[model samples]
Target: MGWYGQVKTNRQLQVRCNYLNGTVNKYLRPIGGITIVADIEQMKISEYIDRAVIPLPKAEGTDYRASTITPPFGPRFNAAPPKPRGQTGFKLDGNVVSWANWKFHLAFDARVGPVISLASIYDAKKKSYRQVMYRSYISELFVLYQDPTEGWYRTMLFDSGEFGLGNFAVSLEPLNDCPSGAVFVDGYYAASDGKPVQVQDAMCIFERHSGDVMWRHSDVEREIRETRPDISIVVRMVSTVANYDYILDWEFKPSGSIKFLIGLTGVLQVKAVPYTNTDQIKEEVYGTLVAGNTIGISHDHFLTYHLDLDIDGDANSFMKTRLITKRVKDKNIPRKSYWNVEHEIAKTESDAKIQIGLNPPELLVVNPNKETKLGNNVGYRLVPGSAARPLLTIDDFPQIRAAFTNNNVWVTPYNKSEKWAGGRFVDRSRGDDTLAVWTEKNRRIENKDIVMWYTVGFHHVTCQEDFPVMPTLSVGFELKPTNFFEYSPVLKTVPPQHLSWANCTK
Candidate 1:
């Protein structure tokens, strides 16, 4: 009944009120064969079929509150670190954040959780901030389930387009969610009734020092040792999308690198089965049996990002430096093979579409007009995340609707209107207005203002550990300076005497 193509109206919804004890957790309980489809616009509802009735799932031991647990808890993994004595390194002037050598503007959007714009890093050598990225954000997010049952076939979700990621974002907990010195920021949005609603503590920003070194070198023969502290500023937010919680982070480092992290955690979407144990099953249940009569369905998640990278200026081009293997022709050569880098400039959007794999080329967005002193292009290279492509066929409805995920990386001419990857209006949307359709035009992109779209994804195959609640699973990508920097910026950071170790005798 929820199947859109089968129904006449696209605004129709199929609803089932299942029971887990007295609570309705539709995933763990199914009302068996009864479905009611209602249309929101026309205000019409079709008659439902009542073929069977199943027993309600017992919701014993479902309480997750800290006070309700009877057994002793396990040992804690982390201890509170020592508090800092000095003022924080980062400064928050309204929405503009300045930390170390990086300055960026951060804003919350109803569609996407966070919008990072005018992100430029300062160059001490030049004594001016250079353009790195103009605007960057998560364009669209698609989560597709793999169950083929009648009630679950149409379980795909366009989280960002259909339901705004910011709309579902909840308040972040202090000290627990963020560090002790984190600065909290609030957000506001218009409600359905056209009233401004404020979401307090919507985001937090803090500098992270995880006891990791930025750079280190030791020379016993020369009696020399040096190291630099690894410090980075992090802007964090958590969006609660129904049964899933997404933790989004934007990290800025002193070396002119930016990282985007997507952490997924929440209850698993489960199905009520007839049998209680896996030993009693013989056929494909479409998932793994986690608990009594509960089957956790397998699924895939894809979050496509719209990165408008301006390496040094607005005019930029995409370059793929492929590492192709070269066989040794000379028999006297000791090495059997070596890899040579073949640089290719993407002339059009079609030329930039790439599928990353075991042998992925080095993807970069560089300014053709700007170069280092050695004449190397000024660019920021992409470090791809744990990206996963859809296993479904291209003709599949979900695959077609989210056709942007066909490739792990894509480059398109900067068009202001073409922001959303799944389309403008994703409510019961088809594949018509997807990113794949727009790229068919294949506009010229060489040395022009272009956007690079990167997909951060993962395939989730459920296990017993993900049952009652799941641990946070994270995956993301990084944009690092390639030839954009003249040399490592960490070399200029003066370390304190405590960290310098100059007095130690070798």
Candidate 2:
């Protein structure tokens, strides 16, 4: 039912059956042309629509479970892995974890899965642990599919707020979901009935040793080289929201950088159609036809995070450094124009609102009172990668409620109630309490305890390859030291000692 001017206004749940019919993937088989609209409050069906008789998706080759495959899939590695290392590399006491130069408390939220609180990094120069971010977690995400049809238009979803991330946390597979040496953590959250429900292996902590170098230099002139192995600790959780799996990782690096990594992989919410090839369709499909009788729905994912960066202390300001092009005053220089940084310390909440991907400025959350040895303000830069802005018009219902995606970045005074980017009451929300509405106050945030919000957007245009199950499409952003350290923190650090060399056997 179209929700524009009032077609069906009652609280409703449109039911679509996906019952497994002979080994077919439930998601791949959305029983089309039949929708059951039931008003739970009234406890009756408002409408039972059966418009057309659409052929069901084939039952062949639709099952993805390994056990269902005809030939067994072999193990990832041919040979057994090496023995475990002598050290576990991280210390865990209850919910608190200490790894590398980082120490933080890990807790689970009913709405947001894993919460990293009191996150501080050790400072060798200060001989103590200094606060970087007090607490950080993904607040909400808007998964909006681009289909104007009566059955598909209402697919706009607030993943975390409507369906709690903690509620969807699935137990991770060993050695597959995580490495051999990873430590698993259990999660618990309150159910609707107020009883605590526990999810085992809900999260994992592992030290990633990818071959990528952390730091390396080759001084051929002096015939010398220095290199450090890239070793970082990752706290990971996977939230399966019906048809999508969002793998979230909080990676802490030894080089004083923190990365928020998200990988999207799962079955696409495909629409069943009559066409098998592109040439057969004459009208707007709204998506690509990856399989016979299937149209992969085009969609957008906006993942917004809440970062309460203490930055050595609570009183911090967000800075935007715009690179401005200036012409040479004197025609003495060979270059006609040169660019230099023009810094602006955000005085109010509105001043910090930024739409990324358009001459994006260098973003930094800095403590003005704290300085380095060279008298530079201490700060951590927001290194945005693959940013996105909403493409939908402002009047759209989804855009109105999820107006937080209007800007890639926003800073607001830290408020306990303002944690949810989309209003806390997201189910059937009317955009009255969104971050976009809260910032309308234009409150003063300079030198105040503030929280920074960042949105990572993925504008997915459905393609042939993304049809069945999507291979991981990953995107991430980093928080790196700016002028916080006088020098590279790892410059003077000793390289990790290798315990042994490979032995040549007879």
Candidate 3:
């Protein structure tokens, strides 16, 4: 039964059978539907016996199918011929990439998919390559559906762990998925039976020019103009986990920035509805009615990333440059107010835990010992993209199990056993070995070899456009150079020449 705006609204029916006990007992059957009537702190289960279980209308009806009887008949149509463009600029020496004075080793992992190692950038002033991040990868992703029905109550899925990421990688669609001139890489993994299988073209590497200026200077007095075009190399991989497809990209910039991006697309897992139109629904439905008898449920996606940043050979400290409004204290000025910067150095694990807000402080990981030419600490600032913190309450079961998502950012001293945010085997894990459990020790992180963990999430509210298939939803974060460089890294790089602008007549 659907929720009718009741306080105890979750209607999760428990389907009891012999399959759960690993025995075939024909006498076993379902007892009753269990409804969660309590708050998120203490979930109280109540048996719902009066409601009748009825089969919903199927979506294969004629009104729901796309019609081919229109004037534009369904047939193959030619769009344009493929103009082959050759690859240049980037040179790959067997999994090692060397571009823009940045060198790193990219390897495919069976669980995490792509693990980047030995990332370093060439420092012009030092005349040597400086180590940035030693290794970084996506730790885990926890997705939970909003529906409180028995079928979806325990829908907490550990996508990367439960099903190996490399096992689900699909072949790239040459020009459609990735741009032309992209180099494809194959992935190999072991199956459940211990037999090795390979997926061809599982990842693609390419360089793209978005026509953005990296740096610009125009001196009217000197009659000189200079501008450098922005160019980047992206390592792309797509994995299909059951009904949803995830597109992950590791983008490298010439300006010394590493961007981690994720895109969610694919068919939606919809529920069968009974109403055909708005007039048929007397009460509020829990989801959106995409078709005649289909309801796309609401859900949330939370992804945790493990970053082992070694800025100038580890021994780094986390600092928060907080900006606060300051009223003018000078009587001579007669001004109203201004903002002031207050620097806060994190001394402990608890001090480093961050909860993002409208105007959060500038988070930076810096080596206090290493100074730039300006005498400032060499560091990299974390720039977040479109992301959300987990909305699930801290005391909830799924929240406790995935406690790493409680805060937006967390820094801890490097520990080998603390890889997965939800523990090693998270198929149906409890809250025992989670990140929250590890942070309880309150270890010191200041000026130590530390690891940073950030959670990026999205609270999805279903709409009509997300009916049968959903458009790609992307969210990510970037690690950009901050005082680590005395000036722009691409200041001396050459810029591409612009071509003649085309008119309508061609």
Show how many residue pairs clash in every candidate, following the order shown: 0, 0, 3
Minimum summed lDDT over a 10-residue window in model 1 is located at 1-10
How would you encode candidate 3's per-residue C-alpha lDDT over 406-494 as one tens digit per residue? 88889999999888888897754666788888988899999999888988888877777764457798888999999998887877786
Measured by TM-score, how close is model 3 to the native structure? 0.84
> Can you tell me which runs of candidate 1 are displaced by over 4 Å?
1-8, 20-33, 81-87, 496-506
TM-score of each: 0.94, 0.95, 0.84
Clashing pairs for predicted structure model 2, backbone only: none
lDDT of 1 by residue, 112-190 (tens): 8899999999998888999999999899999988998766687788889988988888898877788877888887888
Tally clashes: model 3: 3
The candidate that wins on lDDT is: 2
lDDT of 2 by residue, 1-506 (tens): 22343534667777677758775568888777776888878999887878887777766766777777776665556533643532368999999999878999999887999999998988888889999989999999789999888677878888999898889999998777888688899899989999999999999998888768888999999999999888899999999999999999999988889999999998899888888788999989788887888888889999999999999999999999999999988878787888999999999988999988668899999999998888889999999977778999989888888899999999999999898999878877777788999999999888889999999998999887775678899999999989887778777667777656456342
Candidate 1: deviation at residue 343, Å? Answer: 0.2
Q: What's the CA RMSD for each of the models?
A: 3.2, 2.3, 7.8
> Each candidate: what lDDT?
0.84, 0.86, 0.76
Error of 2 at 102 (Å): 0.7
